[model samples]
Target: MKTRKEKTGFRIPDLSRAAGPISSIVAIAVGLMIGFIILLISNPARALEGFAWIIGGGINSAKDLGNVLYYATPIIMTGLSVAFAFRTSLFNIGASGQFIVGALGAVLVGVKCTFLGSFQWVVGLLAAMVFGAVWALIPGLLKAYNNVNEVISCIMTNYIGMYLVNWIVKSTVYHQLTNRSLPVANEANIPKLGLDKLFPGSSINGGFIIAVLICIFAYILLNKTTFGFELKACGYNRFASRYAGISEKRSIIMAMVISGAMAGIGGGLLYLAGSGKYINVEDVLAPEGFTGISVALLGMSHPIGTLFAGLFIAYITVGGSYMQLAGFVPEIIDIITATVIYFAAFALIMRNLLQRFRLRKGGERT
Candidate 1:
């Protein structure tokens, strides 16, 4: 019989290594700890109250949670875009450019294609996806054939898309009084599916539902299909896959196109949410494009995980907004989120170490 000392390892084993949601959960918890520390530093007397406010959600209305869903809709799409490209080993940093072009397409359809009545919004969304795909295709092709760095090309396209969309809006749908694109026709609006009644004072609509379904669809496409397998194979090792007869260049282009489409769909869903979002001649990149990258990282680059990641990010954002009532600046929310991202990276490292330990222990046992 094994002695008591032999029953277990001399040192305690760290459980963080096992594959599961443990890492993500620990990352979030530690992130909150950091945020709490910040809160205490900023306002010692009101720190407890402010911290509660950050996590209390809404004290007065269901609309608070509803608004979180509203904000999450587009991010979920953008997150999926980033995650899909990441899985294919293509860093599509041009999601911003794709998102802008897609928004332009949706706006055009919203303003001119209202004649289609109830079918107008659907057509507008499809147009947006096509526009985004086309925009990303330039960088994809350049990377595939000319060996151009996609990151640089994507950055260039971001400016191009920004200026192009600005010009398009100015020349066509310019609303001079508002200094933005004109209001979309009601016919092009996404239906609320009675969510408005369920959560009053919120912009919640069917777009969130659509985003969820699309997330599932992307998961199936990436994990359960032969094409997905080939794409991943190309990503894992282009030379090996080429020897196996895979068209590496084609895979690269297709992966980017799909990524851009997802981002474009996000733009459409956001602007068509019946919330009166309009394109302005802002001198800034679409923030959602970058936010999606963070969401993808937080979700560990999995499409299904991205869905929940998007939702959680949105939830925290909403909670963060409430911090203002407790005398905190809105920017404090940004700090908290950044800290969360930082700790999440640390948690990933710990998880990797844990996995290595498990493998080594198995080897010793054998």
Candidate 2:
């Protein structure tokens, strides 16, 4: 909760604030324990090797680590989107919709606008934020004024965005025979920022840097500003916040809009990064958005914590892809992830237990 601390960079500063990180670590450990049980049943012989990879795959090489960063980039944004809205007691479930719309905005700009060098990505990214904000605005307005349930509106908007963007791609920028949007313009592609040299031909790009900066920004916004104070007050109790003269409606709307804009920028950063992946006519929701929910939960909706959670999730995904080496189905990774989510519920329990034990130990020492 924003009430937990004031402006203080990344440090937790106490055991009380350490609960979130401790819970996340517990979740990971429990998830891995479940994974081991599954592996024991499936293939006891190769289980150890597979588990080893799951834990250490990201560091196998520079390329592997780069892949982790590439995967983390979008989710980091999406995670922040979810976290930011949550701080204001709003659920921005439309991040998927915002993400797709943002992707569409970037694609449109990439195809139509021509900017010099890296600035193209800048323009496209801004367009994405605008598109995403616009897409989320109606839902925010409905939640603010009409008292509509934000989750329902957000879900409906998500599907609408997905279908609408798919249609636009098919009609405007569909790559012939590829079934995907056309490649972004050369200028629109995200700069390597010298990472290409380090990873030596990986998907790593400037997006990672942007994601980190944004996470820090989110931290600052939530902890250091008067505006953030109002949002958090609203989140803690809208009735009390309203009584205190904080306009709950305006805070809710602004929170949703900001959350959506973050998601949109994430989509732009990802597609514009020159990854082979592109938006297509698929009816499927953007996986990155949903994955962000898990990341937010794992991080307990903390910006700095989300960074580690995103990276951890991305790391496991890369490691999971290599499960075939141990003669296991790669889908096992999904099972592990699901189990992790399931285990995430226990994080609070673990935290409570830790708290009790710590108190008891203190009492004894006293």
Candidate 3:
């Protein structure tokens, strides 16, 4: 028995399947540790209490939990948008442009199409998706036909969209008194579906439910469909996929379009939540789109993972808001969020290294 055990030698555990989740967890923990250290440095006396608030503030009440879900809806949608594009090997940094364009379209419909009665919101949502897709199409066309880099085109579009939207809002939907777009008609607001009674006083609504359903749909689309296979194949090897009869150009375009549609839906959901949020005439890009990039990275570009990641970020955000009572400034919250996202960027690299190590050990064992 001793001879047999000695002969067998040691074997490495298979961790290929678990690499993504494990790397993400490690990154998140490291980020939180850094945040705690920063808190200690900023306010040594109240560090522990502030950190506690950062971790547990979301559970303070039913209202806080509800607000978490409400805040999560748009990020979840944008995260899915980025995650889907990542799967197709497309970097869609134009989500900000797509989001703002979609918002404008939705608001246009919501304000001017109250004649549709209860159906106004549905039409507004669809308009938003269409607008976003059209905005994204420019980069897709450039990338597929002219060999232009999507990143460059996306950056250009973001500024163009920002300025263009500023003009459009002021010309068509501007309210001089508020310097923001006019409020949407009541009929165009998303239905709460009894969430009002459940979460009372919170902005949570059907948009959260819709975000959940879309996450499930995205998972199924990416994991269980022939089309998804083609898109992924193109991503893995564009030339090989083209040789195998998969249309790489078409896949790229479709991926960008779908990604844009998801972002567009996020814009619509945020505005239609009846939370009194309106588009202000500013030259700034939407922060939700950039936040989506972080969510996608933290989730390792997986649909369900993106959903959970979005929720976690939103939870941390709500908790961070409570830290002010413990003597931490609002800027401290931004620092912590930036730190977490910065660490999240390392997750993919860690996963790849883990897989490489596993493969090397497996070869040795064989």
Best-matching candidate per TM-score: 2
lDDT of 1: 0.86
TM-score of 3: 0.91
Model 2: lDDT equals: 0.86
Clashing pairs in model 2?
none
Candidate 3 residue-wise lDDT, 158-258, digit = tens: 89988998899999989999899999999889899999788888899999999999999988998999999988888777898999999999988888888
Please report, as a residue range, the 10-residue window in candidate 2 with the lowest summed lDDT: 1-10
| Cα lDDT, all candidates | 0.86, 0.86, 0.87
Task: Summarize candidate 1's per-residue lDDT along 1-366 as a digit string, tens digits.
Answer: 112334665544445335336677777887778888888898988888778877776434699988989999999989899899999988888888899889889989999887899998999899899999999999999999998988899999989999999999999999998899988899888889999998899999998999999899888988999889888888887888899999999999999999999999999999888897999988889999999998888887888788988988888788888877888886776777787777767754676677688879988999
Candidate 2, residues 229-276, lDDT tens digits: the string is 999898888898999999998988888888999999999989898887
Better of 1 and 2 by lDDT: 2
Candidate that beats the other on lDDT, 1 or 3, i.e. the better one: 3
Lowest-sum lDDT 10-residue window in model 3: 1-10
Q: What is the lDDT of residue 64 in candidate 1?
A: 90
Q: Which of 1 and 3 is the better model by TM-score?
A: 1
Could you say which candidate leads in lDDT? 3
What ranking emerges by TM-score with the best candidate at the front?
2, 1, 3
The clash numbers for all candidates, in the given order, read 0, 0, 0
